[model samples]
Target: MTTKNLLVELFVEELPPKALKALGEAFSTTLADSLKASGLATAHSAVTAFASPRRLGAHISAVRSQADDKPVSQKLMPVGVALDAAGQPTPALLKKLGALGFDAGAVPQLKRQPDGKTEALFLDVVVKGATLADGLQKALDEALARLPIPKVMQYQLADGWTSVNFVRPAHGLVALHGADLVPVQALGLTSGRETRGHRFEAAIDPVMLLDADHYARQLLEQGAVIASFADRHAEISRQLRAAAAREGLTPIDDAALLDEVTALVERPNVLLCRFEEEFLAVPQECLILTMKANQKYFPLLDAAGKLTNRFLVVSNISPADPSRVIEGNERVVRPRLADAKFFFDQDRKKTLASRVEGLAKVVYHGKLGTQGERVERVRAIARAIGERLGGTALAADADTAARLAKADLLTDMVGEFPELQGIMGGYYARADGLGETVADAIEDHYKPRFAGDQLPRNDVGIAVALADKLETLVGLFGIGQLPTGDKDPFALRRHALGVVRMLVERQLALDIDALIDTAVKTFGPLVADPARTVGLVVDFMFDRLAVSLRDQGYGAQEIDAVLSRRSSRVHEVPRALAAVRAFAALPEAASLAAANKRVGNILNKSDAPPAAAADPARFVEPQERALFDALQAASAPSAAAFERGDYTASLQALAVLKAPVDAFFDGVMVNADDPALKANRLALLASLHAAMNRVADLSKLAA
Candidate 1:
């Protein structure tokens, strides 16, 4: 029972930082799955990846020896014996066994019990074990040849050369199982124990990787590339943080830039650089963005929390003089900030109000119309959402902000850098002498640029945000651009989640359905087809909301039951989901679900609605009378509680009826011979349905 370690490294030209991070994870998971499917489960198998802008490498551990043969058993019955008295085996049993490759003699042997009344048979079918290399090679080759590198190229010269391309040209590959090289080749790469290191810094020596532990150390000292992304990333952060701390400034925590930095260097060398103190006169955000977006430098600030004219940059190579490196980076960053400052100065010359008219020429989408038209639609929808939330009059600024929010998208500043979309608009709004509220709304409207980003704080901001998200969702879905799988071309999923957060976090009394309806109507004239837009909006948002709810610990079945009712209200779904969860928590809840199922079952079988209420004069059973009186009392508390959103109270009230329900079912026959008694029992079950339906259709939940 010897274990083998496998190492595979692909050195390539510089890859996009984001792509490298994702590929590392995908490679590891896919490798594990490939191993499992190959029937090679050793004590442990893991994929460890090392990524830089230049290369991506994976090291696997304890890759099992050839898969071991396992004993398999097959049940067998003679064709004649499998047949019934009709002289044929049971058709289902015969077909199943036949498809499983069963033969009478080859089948597993079975014996009769002491009773010896029935015959039995079985077969032990021994499968030949495969060499671990046999399975491992195929899995490795297929994974390497068709790895999940979304973008690839073809790189073969003519005349039978291996010519597959990936994220970048695969220069060299190191593949090994223990000390032996596994015989697999792809993309002109032949599996071997030798690997190349530090594409630019180290010699192209034939370095042999003998084992996982040894392999890591060799790559660290002689190979020159920190093959572990996690190790490299931590080292970069440590150096960057220390350098920034020496200058009495805090490093801006940018996860995106951190990832990029991880890809940019091998042996990270962090150095602090400074710009002119006067540059701090520019907006803090502008300076930070210029450094991060333009130069990929980590911005540093002083203890007073002000920009210190200092920044930290990580370099792959440790230069002869670190001072020279710092100066060189400063030289590059200075002009980028100057360009930003120039854009800021030029943009402030014209007020956002004056520039607002410029949106008419900016096409948002050729099919959806101009930015100006989109603004109008956003304003109208925001106003509608505001009114729905009981803030109709106070929402005036929201309308104004929505009208000018996209004005900056046409401004020279935004044109130079589209990432500054709403941000540039906010600056222009402030320069135009608009009130703080309007400018802030414009800025905060896009506050949450991505997942986990801060949401809008003001009602006006929330309204405009909702309007923007809904319009995009409805417009795209109307044109059939809905997100499928990872292909969210328009980021519709993020937008939908934004709407959900707005309602839940801001506690906005928004009926998502109503807002979606308003959005659909506002775009009705613009959309190619109006009828499909409404349904698309509803289904799309429900899907996004379902994901959001599930992340919040809601059961899928409960979400399904609540959403199945087609409740357009976002605020209510959470409440309904809460009620369903609480109802489920009841000791009697499972029994109640089962009870409702029984009721549904009986109704389906009867295929008839309950009979008319029993005539009081003909009411003959004491149990029936008690059930009727209890139903009247139970309906009051549950109905009142449900109306007030007191779902807990409603469920508690329902619990009071569980006892009576069980007793009535046990002591009383629902289909009694007496028509009067039968009607009363039917009325009782119908009453339960009405009460339960207020919270959720409990029957839809699994018992």
Candidate 2:
């Protein structure tokens, strides 16, 4: 029943910077979970993960040295099959007992239990608990096996003949229960108290850990390393902000860059460094990206949020006079900035218009032709959409923008950093003497590249953006390269969601169906059945829309109701949803929804279609007459409000029909004995159904 704190560590060469945090968290969580599963730790046990450039480890508190013995009962076999008719042990029974490390004398100890139609013999045994050493070894193995390693390295062990595969070359392993070494081995190394730290600046060569709880402190004081990834990240952030604050500047905020830097250094020392001011002539995006992506430095920004000539470097070592470190970082970063500047200067020398022809040589997809052909299709779609949105000026700008959007792909700067594709295009378009509208559209066409990202800025941008996304969706779906399961190699889902976001968020007047048809026609014979392709792509976009709406906090029923109308104008979805929510809150909402569902069912089962307008003269029953009058009163105002885009008002106006609709269903039979009466009732119900559903299908709200 003794409990103790535990520590485990795996020392190795520097780990992958980007994957280190995940690896550390996974190792600790999986190891602790395994221990708890095996009853070696209780639910209240606490675990702390530690990760650095050279090590991954965990410290767990309140872990039991050994699990308690447990009583177990296992079914052996049916009673008939285990023993003979004489109540003696048969050969089968003897064999089963022997397999379980039992002898013939143990036969009488077996218990008989009912198992459905037959009674089965059960064996009862007390299982011995696992010692800390044994349990820790199994947990260690499991944790190592489950690590999310980006890649594995194969290296020879100390024995030279033996080799192992791991994220890095494992040089040491440490396992301790309290102050006692648990003596577990992994990666060809045995557990020990000694672990190396800070390859160059450790106060001691092999910093010996005193106890399980002292791991982090010892590493920091004697080993000169910040062992916790989160702590190291926070420390580096603090230093960067403080250092930048002194100069009245701010470090660029990038979580990914911060994480990568944290993993690259064991001990962080933030120092300021500067580049030549002339290099700032190139876009700050170019300079910031080069420094952060290539050199892992944090770029400083001025008050206007413009990139400054200075940047911050997170050094792994600290010296007495840090000027050398600052100068060293500055010296190293100059060439990287120079390369970016060189690429920018070289790229601007040639106009984006000149690169259009080169796109034909670059393949977009094996089946979908080249980027050049894709551009033409996009231009066609963009022009069509723009013409519908605005007359001629907008179409011209959109066409120009769509044609040049991908031209930057061939440029030196973009070729070096593909992430700068659309951004560089905007810059180059302006240099080509294209106006701001065209340049902005060229840049913003790829807007909303990811979830929660911004959409296109202007009307022209919206047109080109829609065209680009539709081209990808239509082209890929046309070639039967549809995404299945989790494998969306072409990011078609993102494209679809992007389209949905633009239509709904921007409130574009363009019809989705018409847009799809325009895009399909642009592809020509490439699509075997343009109609079918259009249908598939539209459905896919709707599916993405449902998910997006759900993520935005709309209920499943609300979304289902709104989408059921298949309203061509996706931009009106939000308004429709708002109306549905407002309607749902009404006291009469549920009854009206239920009545709408019943009315639909009756109309669907009718022998013939209902009349376009109900004949009030044919209403034989008083209830039918009353409902028809109510429908007329509600329909007029509701139709007017709906046309005016006041969806909530339109739906609320229909609330007056709740009483008349309830009375019609209660006192009148829709399928009356007389054919004329039934037809008249069907027509009356049809009118009511249409009136209630102008905003959304109320039947979808029925329980």
Candidate 3:
């Protein structure tokens, strides 16, 4: 079987920058996968993806011209149905064989095999494989059908009456197998050896590709285009660093922005541009965001990490003069920076306190009332949390921060850039002379807006952050606005995960359930059912916590063993998980876990509660006496260590009961036919169960 490297390209209008990377990845992988599935490509086939603003392509190595033919034995039908009692083919069998391209003469090749309870007749035949043209066409069709297109546009083709739907207008399609042209058609375009290069800078109007192996080289050398997205990105990074290094400044690092810029240009040419120093009077965040978001430029930073007026521009064309390109970019960025500065200047004209009244007109949610109302609820929750975490001063600061947190929503700065909500508020807070604690808290309240994001830096911020997230969780849960699988329009799961991170990572001594209750009360009548919503929100948070821990590499049983207790001390959960993991590795762990499971089953089936302590005089069995003594000795050390918060040592202390527990269950009949003896034994077993499960439910680890 002869194999060749294949190259395929689809040229279209410029793609959506943010989606280009995903589109490119999906295109190459899906095409290669479809080829492999059809047996045209093997597991060793090497695939490289090419993506630019106007094209998506793939280069695959070791693709066979035609797949290998294979012999297949296919079942026809049951013997009784296919043949008569005369042991000859029936009319139905003849019809089936005719449809399968077989005939009466081929019936001699039929074999019998037992299928379930009946025997079936099978036919063995050699099947021809798909040729390169057919396989590549099928692969291309599938790849286009599933490109993760963000949006589709329907336009009429050149025929005027026929229409096609695609992410962008399709202009060209290229399909080459080594030096040979594979006949394939897509979007009304036939495969060709011609493809256009850069829109403006290509040396040739259309670069004539020679073979599959030279596609990338020809594009870069003669076409002024970097065909590989990864190569283009690395080239841009290298140029940006080199351009910024001349002035002893560093380019602001943003992966998303870099990827978007790479998608915008075919070949990158990094150039330095600058803005007026007066614009630097505004917050660096405002200037940086305006440049990056609006202009797609990288801001430069000094050695001290302070934003500088100079920025780097990734130009699509490298002009000999280059001064005009630099000037044009600088001119384009000036207005955007001016708008940011104007918004900042107009915002700080009034203190954050003045904006508090304006939030009443801003709706936080339809069911949750206005932002003003939400702010009041947050203030109450924050005050309560602060009072618990600290004494008096922390509570006062938390209340102030919570009240002013959403006030920035009404400011001109935040209205122009919503991502700067909390950040701008911090700037305004300081300008109003509200002190560093209040300013930092206002900024840090939204600290953990995403996964791996930091938590609040101060106690005041922790209180307000916790209160804000709790209010949202409880209020939305009460309204039945919960997140479903994949569709988290409200970001409830993220909010819940944020709360979990703060509680566990911050090690705050806060009960999530109690906080939910407090938050529910603050909602007044806004929450439909406060009591029920409390439990729902608590469960959702713990579920998120379990997922977070599992993602952090903790085992399912280890997490389940700790969380099954429904303990409110979330801060202690990590330590509990650590202790459970340690206990699981002990020599006596299996027997103890199994015994703990049996004890729980026995106690659950009994009608009466086990006594707090077993009556030793009624312990008629020596096995019961021995188990009771072992449990008594184990409980003391476990209790001492638990009081000191040494969960590992505490759980490890219960290992002494394994031998006596096994003996008791093996030699003594728990239901001794005497009600009092049974009750006492239940009491003894209950005590043992309690001692073993102080940190986590040991039964969850049982096999």
Tell me the TM-score of each prediction against the true structure: 0.83, 0.96, 0.98
Give all candidates' CA lDDT scores.
Answer: 0.74, 0.92, 0.93
Clashes of each: 14, 0, 0
Error of 3 at 17 (Å): 0.9
Error of 3 at 259 (Å): 0.7
Local error of candidate 1 at residue 274 (angstroms):
1.3
Per-residue lDDT tens digits for candidate 1, residues 465-531, read: 8889888888888777778878988988888888888777776666666687788888766677776
> Residue 469 in model 1: shift from native, Å?
1.9
Off by over 4 Å in 1: 1-4, 24-43, 53-56, 63-139, 156-164, 175-186, 189-195, 199-213, 302-307, 390-392, 447-449, 527-532, 598-618, 667-684
Query: lDDT tens digits, residues 1-703, model 2?
Result: 7799999999999899999999999999999999998899989999999999899999998998889999999788898999899988889988998998999998889999999999999999989989888999999999999999999989999887998999999989999889999989999999999999898899987999999988899999999999999999999999999999999999999999999999999999998888899999998888988898989999999999998999999999889899999988899889988999899999989999999999999999888899999999999999999999997989998999999999999999998988898999999999999989999999999988999999999999999999999999999999999999999999999999999999888888779999999999998999999989989998998899999999999999999999988877999999999999999999999999998898888888888998788788887779888988888898999999999999999999999998888898889988889888788778888888888989999999888
Q: Candidate 3's residue-wise lDDT over 1-703, tens digit each?
A: 8789999999999999999999999999999999999899999999999999999999999999999898999999999999999999999999999999888998888999999999999999888998999999999999999999999999889999889999999999999999899999998889999999998899987999999999999999889999999999999999999999998999998999999999999999999998899999999999999899999999999999999999999999989999999999999999998899889889989999999998899898988899999999999999999999997889999999999999999888888899998999999999999998999999989879988888988989999999888888888899999888899887888888988888888898888778899999998887877889988998998899999999999999999999999999899998999899999999999988988999899999989898888999998878888998888888998999999999999999998888898899889998878888888888888888888888999999999
Off by over 4 Å in 3: 116-118
Candidate 2 runs further than 4 Å off: 83-90, 101-119
